[model samples]
Target: MKESGRKQGAASPCAACKLLRRRCAQDCVFSPYFPADEPQKFANVHKVFGASNVNKMLQELPMHQRGDAVSSMVYEANARVRDPVYGCVGAISSLQQQIDALQTQLALAQAEVVHLRVRQTASLSNHGFGPGSPNSSGSPSSKLMGSQVKPIFDMDMVVDQASLGESMWSC
Candidate 1:
């Protein structure tokens, strides 16, 4: 009986060995990680970092760290292939910029809410319906301004993209 399982004499080569056109040894380090099914995984890694270099790296790393190292290398390799110049850094920068823009938008929205609240309070005072007034109880404005725990702004409010470039504060 052959020890090759389904195959008689030869065993299926790993992706690395298949790409390199070499025999996949029984103790091959890459066989466990780079299976024959997913050829593109190894191909991208090989394209970004040479097979020799990858082999050396895997050999140098401890068994426990090998998987994480391989995952990081694959991610960086894929990113490098997509954006040769900036790679992962460009993606990170873009996400950070988006965060900053959203923060600014949030600040602007909060400021507008405060401005409107001040106007409403001043109008109430002018009409003798301020917080201490007799008619303040059961008033819609008093109920809205007092004892409200939740944020006043609608979280899903649409922001105007055109206003992103404008100054955050206006006189």
Candidate 2:
């Protein structure tokens, strides 16, 4: 009695045929488990089985099984490709949210700047020389002279100079 090359005793089949064990033809090597027509579906098979073994197994599958395998492979590959695109879309949406938040902050900052400028202008005018100053009612020269009132320190200086000469003579 010649023993077949197939490994025995492990009823657990490959991941792909595990769910549909009944659908898989008992042949084990190339049955429905190895769909060769779908090259991409079996793309990862080479990683598990050696390339030559996967090729030989796929080649032995029936034409209909090969076509079904190929279709399944394409669907799997498309899903893999879609995952990254979906992730990128999620990233873009988050970025847009951040941009919107920044824009709102910028708008608030601009409004605060305008409010500060208005307050500054109001304070300057109330102190009498900005655009709405009361000094506008007076003649320009009078307004200028009024704005330049003699410093109180100059009187102190004159008194100090007068006392200095007397103090020096006394000494």
Candidate 3:
């Protein structure tokens, strides 16, 4: 019988061994993670961490943990190759900046909505359909808008609460 066009007992060199130009033993540590088909995985790792360091790291870890260690090493190695100075930290900082900018934009949009609703309430009040007017019950839209807009526009109450050390957006 044969497997992958080689005899059953025959062994093909893994990526590490092939790149290093050496024979792959039956119990080679890199064979499981660095297969022959994905040579670049091992090449980048070898470039950043060196083959000896990878070998030592794998040999120091337990059987189950070695796979995770290899995965982390590959990710860090790839990041290091892409950005040698900052690596993964640069990516994280960029994402955090985007989040902060989006949050600021969201706050501005909410303020605009509140301003529009306040204008609508003032217009209705001028037409005798305001909350306390005799024709308040005649305009269902005005009543609903008045009820919704009051809480957001109560700046004095919000300022008082903030003075009491209560956070509005706290988790």
**How close is every model to the real structure, measured as TM-score?**
0.73, 0.31, 0.69
Top lDDT model? 1
Winning model by TM-score: 1
lDDT of 3 by residue, 1-171 (tens): 434333355567889989999877767899899998999999999999999999999999999999999999999988889999987788778888887777667666666655666676687678776768775553436355665454434322222323223232432
Residue-level lDDT of model 1, residues 1-171, one tens digit each, is 546432345578889999999877778888878989999999999999989999999999999999999999899889999999998898888998887787788777866765666676677678787767776665535355675655354323434444533535331
Q: List all candidate RMSDs to the true structure.
A: 7.2, 24.8, 6.1
TM-score of 2: 0.31
lDDT of 2 by residue, 1-171 (tens): 433333454344444444233333346544344443444444454433444655464688776686665455445445545564464456567788887777666656655655555565465466675646655654333454575564222211222334434543341
Residue 15 lDDT in candidate 3 = 96
If ranked by lDDT, best first, what sequence of candidates would result?
A: 1, 3, 2
Q: Output the TM-score of candidate 3.
A: 0.69
The better-scoring model by TM-score among 1 and 2 is: 1
Query: Which stretches of model 3 miss by more than 4 angstroms?
Result: 1-10, 133-171
The candidate, 2 or 3, that scores higher on lDDT is 3
- Clashes in candidate 2: how many? 2
